[model samples]
Target chain A: MNGFGYLRPDSVHEAAEAYAAHPGARFLAGGTNLVDLLKLGVERPSTLIDIGRLPLDSVQELSDGGLRVGATVRNSDLAADPRVRDRYPALSQALLAGASAQLRNAATTGGNLLQRTRCPYFQDLDKPCNKREPGSGCGARDGVHRDHAVLGHSPQCIATHPSDMAVALAALDAQVELYSTAGTRRLPVADFYRLPGEHPERDTWIRPGELITGVRLPAATAGAPSAYRKARDRASYAFALASVAVVLRIQDGVVDQVGIAFGGLAHRPWRARHTELALLGAPATPAAFEGAVALELAHAEPLRDNAYKVPLARNLALDVLNRLAPAPAPA
Target chain B: MTSAPQPGHHSEVTLRVNGKPHTLRVDHRRVLLDLLREELDLTGSKKGCDHGQCGACTVLVDGRRLNSCLLLAVALDGSEITTVEGLGGDGDEPHPLQRAFLDRDAFQCGYCTPGQLCSALGMLAEAAAGHPSHVTGPTAPSGRPVPLDRSEIRERMSGNLCRCGAYPRIVEAIEDVIP
Candidate 1:
């Protein structure tokens, strides 16, 4: 609610230019997350660039048998889209498991991707958080670290990316299409989010004045069974304690292809590449799934309090993969 | 140098409330709830939690329900809105859900009644459109009575907080409106 300049750009290019022209200018999408953060004094952009009027709300079919979801596509509309749900059930499940109805109705696809961490220390200005204020000191390293990170930890920050949709996108190998005054480029979902290694302030790889235009997901086979399961403290409207998004293409009693991603366990969506490597030729049983999970959790470095997240994530990933086993052929 | 002008006293915002438009300037910091009650004199919408957590300020924006308290008056410049007062039968008659609430004595303190009514109306539409609540699954398409069951109702209506503990009667009123 702090006083700031407001500018409504008619186009994405114009929006990008407006951002570069002004320091601390933020592209306002649905305002579900940004506005609340602003109210909490977590963000104090000198200028507010309103991108609501921009023509980025469409969901189009890419020529390469993929989908280009505009940055402004609401979470609710994205989940309700028949094409997304039919092709990528993981995306649908992840979207449906996000905030409440009113929030999903207002949260934009691009906004959801770039949302700041939900770490309690980061949200509280009184606390010293490296993510919120670099070089200030990270209180979470020795404080209440229940929802802290389990992977991709630096000596500086230990915060988890609180996005459910991004987890599925990471496993699907989605690409983020962005626009800037310079030009346009596509960034893989894996590379989009940055770790807190040295400078935790830089959350994403978005350049100055660069606006996320849309996201493109390469279409998979018709029957590739994909799902996202999140284990939270409660049933609904809660951040995940641990979650997994798995897409498996099993054929002839062998795994043809697999994509595994973990959320609530890392600074970004933790793509379980090692787990995939361990499970490629392995049998499709709970034991094999269990064996593959070790490779994924082997690199996990738990904090003083969140050590349980390692086992929780491993079991959750195994459970998700176990559910993907194909049915036996009729005798 | 002159002092900075105080916000929320401007007379420039043109708001379209429940199909009717009004040209009024309000305090920049004054919430939409205050504007509806103090400025424009439309008081059906109540304010429970000034934050977005409560549904006491629930209102319809082009048929979609939102917490009006969280929305800025200036932000709603040209959107069509619907409050509890604007909903009913053919001119002056109350809507069926409104009648149901009255018949069942759905409210006690009645502070959060306005929000509960509007939320129920929107929840009904969601049910008709096959929108699944938390209790629903992706395996089935939306639309099968939505069950209108107790748990579904509770999940769908969690945004609205009722401190009066009038939940049982409220559920009965909502169940009475199932088509």
Candidate 2:
């Protein structure tokens, strides 16, 4: 690992100030992703602002009947939170499905949001990657790219965000809370991530020197029948080949409200907004679910050797939707 | 203001290892795995991939099992760490898990034993604390004890990899001590 200056700020304000003071400083919360990147020479921060000691490790109930999870709250704790499990069950299930138990024990919520992509080219310094080095080139475009993005990808980059939690949050309509010298603000999880248009180097819409404080889970999406299903190369301890997180409410044999998001398919969590719109007020049947899912995935532009992801993702979404609202028994 | 150190490449940290506290100056780039193995001479925790992919560097930090290689020693100031060396009873007497592993013959290489043991210890605590694994049923209530069945044990301990393919015996060993 490269030598870098380290500072453990006492408070959120101090951490933001440290970021402004050091131009190339990065906030180090869990260090699971950043430390590994440092070893690979992919992340070369001049200084590390250790925010692990910051007093942002609690999950509090909001006055609006929602939940505000602190930034540094570990993934294991978040998954095990009674409110999260009972209310936002999809989020809990997603967290449990991601990474290993050891990683979930140390990985923080804020860091998980800002984790870099797992594209092989991006991690290898020798290989040319537009996301890693802007003008270099994209080796994954022609190289080994079975895991590359199929949606919201550009010529510059074809990497996919490797976060199952973010996909669930996107479906749940969660908001990411940010703290910086310019004060605080919040962005919906769906809008926080950016598609690789030209600057694949930028992962999210977060401004420089901005520190993620917490994620807000709205009460409206809580307590509905929700599920997270992932298809991976292994039964456990592997990244998702395709995943789906769905929040559905069927009323009077019709879809009342629905939210769907897919992972391992795009640069960010592919929020099935079009599909949700199609399903709302439609009959809760297998035909409607299949049609709505097909409508949303119609825009998928899959790469070579990855056309399997399209069917995999469709099956996952259809399965999750079916589970949330099973088809009426054949009469 | 208070307890915040100056910005530098090195810092003095106090670590409680194996029930003993030791203060040392460590470089910023030094990982906890190296600190335990190189400085403290606690070589029980082996380094498999050095990256977080492998669980060979697993250790209990503040009673939670985590990859020691991914954690910087300087960042873990004043934290208690328990490694394979700290697990077991007095000289000849082994911990129940260790005894079960031996009884079941759960190893051929024994490289991943330390990590498996530490991870199992942490997994038991987590399950006992009502933390559910992926295999836990959705109807299972949170904040309640989770029954550690065979599938539960396998899912919870999936992070630790044993190349010797002694998984069945490993699961048996974990099952043997689950009372």
Candidate 3:
């Protein structure tokens, strides 16, 4: 690991000030993904503002019948929380499906959302990855493209977003509360991750000094249907090949509202607006899901290696929707 | 920005391991694995895969199991740690999982044994706390507690890799704690 100045700030304001002063500084929380990336030379911040000391680890109830999860809350803690377990099992299930017990114990919520992709080309410093270096060629485009992105990918980059929690948050319409030296701000979770269009170097829309304070869930959509299904090579501790998070409100045996996001297949958590439109007011059946997937995958440009993800995603969508059909009626 | 490799300054960190406090000055870059083995001479926490892949360095950090190699010594300040050396209560009585491993002969190379024992203890607590396993249903039946089965045990114990094909014995040792 490169030797960098490490400052453990006591408060969020101090940490934000530290980041503003040092343009090349990155906040360290749990340091599971960030440390691994730094060791691989994918990210080399001159200074590390350790924010783990900040008293920001809690799961408090919002007045709007939602949750306010502190960014520093450990993944294990948030997932194992009783309220999160029963009320919002999508988030808990997503967390449980990620990394291992040991890693989840050390991984923080803020850090998990900020984790970079696991593409082989991105991790290998020798390879030319546009996400690592803008204007540089994307080696994953031609070589080792199995885990590369198929949707929302540009010629510059085609890497998948690898966070399991972010997808669930997107489905839940969670809003990210950000604090900077100037003031505080909020961004919808859908707006947090930026699609790799022309500039793949910019993976997120977060500003230089902006600190992720908390991810707040909006008012719960009553009778909401939510499910997270991930397909992978292994049963545990492996990155996903393709996954889908579906939040549907099925009323009168039809899809009244649907929120869909795809992981391991896009630059960001690929929010399927097209699929959502197709499924709205449509019957919640296998045939309806197949058509919605078809519309979304229309723009998907799968490379030579990852054509399998197209069908993998379709089947995953169908399976999750089928399981979600029997949920809303009882509620 | 290129970060130059600068030598870290040593700080005095006091850690309570197995109910005993040990005070020592360790460099920021000194990994916890080396600190346990070299400084405190607690070699029970083995170092198999130093990159957190193998759970050989599984030690309790603030009463939770974590890979020791990935953690730095500076990170463990004010934390209560428990290693294989302290798993047995006060060193007089061996932990139930420890005795079970011995009775079952759950090791061959004896390298992955420490991590296995520590992780088993941690896994048991997690199960008892009703922490849902990835392999189990999200809504695992409410009232009657579930027993840890083969697939459940294998999925929970996947972090600790055994190279000598000793998983059978390891599973046997863990299954005794079902009651």
Which candidate comes out best when scored by lDDT? 2
**Per-residue lDDT of A1-331 in model 1, one digit per residue for the tens?**
5565667778887888899898988888777667667667788777778787589898999889999999999887787777887788889889878776666766789999998888888888999988888888888889988998999988899988999999999999899998988899999998899988998988889887888999999977766789898888866677888899999887776777889999999889999999899888777777878888898799988888888888888878877787878765778
User: Comparing 1 and 2 by lDDT, which wins?
Assistant: 2
> Per-residue lDDT for B10-65 in model 2, tens only?
88999999889999999888899999999999999999999988798999999999
Off by over 4 Å in 1: B1-12, B25-31, B89-93, B142-150, B163-168
Clash list (residue pairs), candidate 1: B8-B26, B8-B27, B8-B28, B130-B142
- Docking quality of model 1: it rates as acceptable
Clash list (residue pairs), candidate 3: none
Candidate 2 lDDT by residue in tens digits, A262-287 = 99999999999889999999999999
TM-score of chain A for the candidates in order shown = 0.97, 0.98, 0.96
Better candidate number, 2 or 3, judged by TM-score: 2
Of the two candidates 1 and 3, the one with more favorable DockQ, higher being better, is 3
Candidate 3 structure quality by residue, lDDT tens digits, A238-285: 888998888888889899988888888987888889999999999888
What overall lDDT goes with each candidate model? 0.81, 0.92, 0.83
Best-matching candidate per TM-score: 2
- List interface RMSDs for the candidates, in order: 4.9, 6.9, 4.0
TM-score of 2: 0.97
Assess candidate 1 and give its lDDT.
0.81
Alpha-carbon TM-score of each model against the true structure: 0.91, 0.97, 0.93
Fnat of each prediction?
0.04, 0.80, 0.33
